[model samples]
Target: MKDILFVNSRFLSQEITGVQRFSIELSRSLKRILGEKVQFIAPKNIIHSHIAKELNIIEFGIFTGHLWEQIDLPIFLRKHNSPMLLNLGNTAPIFYKNKTSTLHDVAYEKFPDTFNWKFKTFYKFAIPHILKSSIHIFTVSKFSKKEIEELYKIDSNKINIVYNAINEIFKPIKIKNNQRYILGVSSLNNQKNFHSMIDAFNQIADKNIKLYLVGGINRNFASTKLLDEIDKNQNIILKGRVDDKELVELYSNATCFVYPSLYEGFGIPPLEAQACGCPVICSNAASLPEVCSDSVVYFDPYNVQDIKDKIELVLYNEELQNELRRKGFENIKRFSWEKSANKIIEIIEGLK
Candidate 1:
């Protein structure tokens, strides 16, 4: 087998989103299985990245983010003979050929209005070049693979499905139930559809059940409109960001978890919620149906009334809740970070 060198500059530089989490977890799993055969390479400038602490990272770039990944990283790769590079995030150096890149989604292209133009512009230019140049492409879901193929016109065989997985931190735990509240973990991005979710929750007759929103709730970069809409709501409690322990606790104690994302390459929170034994109600869009299977209560993402109805159904029906929880555990069985890591290695081997 050929040696693999993982490009982890993005993992070092970016915050822990689902993409970053997949990168870090897959790297960790790969390191355990491949041992010294797979080594990690990253840039010098770092953030509060938890994964770097656990892995032996060779950090050596002065530039950060895009500049570092595109310029410094490729130059560094050349110095090391450009060993087969594996990028776990969406972006990869277009000039590099002996590499595979994992793109989580095409939300930038699909919902351009949600992002600042800078983000949308960069991706619209970068992704096609990256996909064309990459030895193979890795994505989190079959839905994403198909989307990438259609958008980029790449052969379906060239893209692999490596599914985003529930972290080990998410497990069923016995926690004293909190006050009647439904939980939602998403960013303040427009695509997360929090506006629709909050509206839906407001329509529900159960005034006692509050909607607890978590993760990047107070992001300074978030859209003013989204922030204003969420801020005006009295029933929606914004939990800015919580550590894994706190998140697990919140999931365990919640009545049910609702994910009303308009689109996703692969949705992880619903899996996490299900792993923590919380019944899930997610949008029947994109990869949600693929990931959750028949385990989750489906609602139309665009319809506030549908979301409201689904939430109420899950809340009142104990039998439905029990059925979903049972199937959630079963659905989660299909994905594991270790299994995903092995699949990545298999793809790499085929590329070699």
Candidate 2:
């Protein structure tokens, strides 16, 4: 069996955040297929320790002084001397030569304003070299793949598109009494464009319909007016930092899922909603259109009236909802964790 070292800097806790979940699932799937000897590089913390239990993978923790993980990871990597390396999220070990890196998006290169100065400075120093040295590049969506090829001037053949899969836990729930609520889940940041979502939802003031938001509320960055409206109108429920079970139940029961993001590498919320048999209304922005395909109702993310109109339309029209459901089932079939793991395995084993 070929020895492969997988490295991730983020908190890889049992709780399934997007990137963490992807890494955990991939590692576990690989171990099951290829055996337990394959190594992993992860953070030394309670979060990652829990991930080891959940994924059931053998891993070595790298205590890389908290700030710049890439700089210190090479020591652990050299000690193990694995044949090939795969950097999951960002920042690969500097010393590794024959290494592949997965760029979830060109978020750092494209949206500098979103990150802090320190991260921006670090990216400026590290990313160019990482791109130059990487053996193969992978991205989560076609939109990001194209962008990376164009921006990095890398060969299209060298880049692979591996779309993120909705966790198997997101299965359909029996519709108990025809629920009427629009659901959104993500961080309340500029990228999510939740302010616009609130504005759009406010316009569709249907007495029966409610808007449910599941994410951290950035009280400082968020608009006071939107917060006030959410507080005043008992229609909106802001559930901050929920468990996967709670999120699954929410998706299973919701009338529709709405995601109005400005940009995404691969929008997972829509996929999760589709898997849970919820009809979706999302923006045609970034990689969302590609992920949603023809399964979801697309609205101009910036247009409040368009979002409001689409939400109203989905609620009123039974035919449209049924059509989306049929198409969503088909769309979800195109993606799975097994398929993703198989692809990753081929790539890892094929490496010279």
What residue runs in model 2 are displaced by over 4 Å at the alpha carbon? 4-16, 56-68, 175-179, 218-229
Which regions of candidate 1 deviate over 4 angstroms? 218-225
RMSD of 1: 1.6
After best superposition, candidate 2 residue 349: deviation in angstroms? 2.5
Once model 2 is optimally superposed onto the true structure by TM-score, how far is the C-alpha of residue 239 displaced, in angstroms?
0.7
Question: Per-residue error at 292 for model 1, in Å?
Answer: 0.7
Q: How close is candidate 2 to the true structure, as a TM-score?
A: 0.90
TM-score for all models, in order of appearance: 0.96, 0.90
For candidate 1, lDDT tens digit of each residue in 1-352? 4676566556767778898888888888988998778877787766854566667787877888888888888888888887888988889888887788889999988888777778888999998999899888899898998998888899998888998888888997776665888999988887899888888887888787888989885465577776776688777788888989999988988889999999999988999999999999999999899999899999999999999999999999999999989998999998999999988888788766
Q: List the residue pairs that clash in candidate 2.
A: none
Candidate achieving the largest TM-score: 1
lDDT of 1: 0.85
